[model samples]
Target: MKAAGILTLIGCLVTGAESKIYTRCKLAKIFSRAGLDNYWGFSLGNWICMAYYESGYNTTAQRVLDDGSIDYGIFQINSFTWCRHGKLQENNHCHVACSALITDDLTDAIICARKIVKETQGMNYWQGWKKHCEGRDLSDWKKGCEVS
Candidate 1:
């Protein structure tokens, strides 16, 4: 019985490790379109973390909150506002797509984040994003983040 339990644990670990890296190149290209290459490394990390917290990285994730409203996709974008910005699936342009816009559009999410940080904290406010991405190679995001 103990051996069976141990094997089950190993199986779970293996499966978890096998999880695919969902690094979407098109999304990164979109960021490049917005001229956010310099910040894409840290920005992508923050976007990943935020999406994980919001929807466990499920691009199709949806849920009904206690407020009797439905939240859609990876970033849990509430339906009404989501419709205002991006398409709903078919193009895979659900909440995840909208999130990509944070880096792609540049003005909306990036500007908003900076404002919030500057208002509550100060300039150089994105230091936290930089800190979180420390030691993680930025080369992976270079397609979108590298200026030169």
Candidate 2:
């Protein structure tokens, strides 16, 4: 009976873990189709994780500041700054968010992110995600996104 119970618990845990990855994979397709995949070089897996950390992938995400301005979009661009990089739109603009990511050069966001990952988290930090999401198929990303 003890061995059977342990096996059941492990099976349940594995199922839950698989479900989470399925959800993240769906979200990855949305972000990739929206233009973020063009300007960002990180893996869709990593980008989905970052979006979860930043704003739960909410496109209408916004933050209010003491100065009374609004920040908008999935990657969270301040209204004042959005105009500098992208077109104005009633709805959040994914293209603008993508452009802002390339602030200095086309590859700036990816290179900068790698540098940050190294400086703050140390080298090989991305290995952590592989451990966390072990056994998940990230290769499905190619079907959903067109690389720039």
TM-score, each model? Answer: 0.34, 0.37
Q: lDDT score of model 2? A: 0.44
Best by TM-score: 2
Q: What tens digits encode model 2's per-residue C-alpha lDDT throughout 81-107?
A: 332334544232222343344222223
The ten-residue window of minimal lDDT in model 2 covers: 14-23
Question: Candidate 2: where is the Cα deviation over 4 Å?
Answer: 1-23, 34-40, 84-148
Q: Rate the local accuracy (lDDT) of all candidates.
A: 0.42, 0.44
What candidate 1 gets wrong by more than 4 Å, as runs, is 1-42, 84-148
Per-candidate RMSD vs. true structure?
10.8, 14.6
Best-fitting candidate, measured by lDDT? Answer: 2
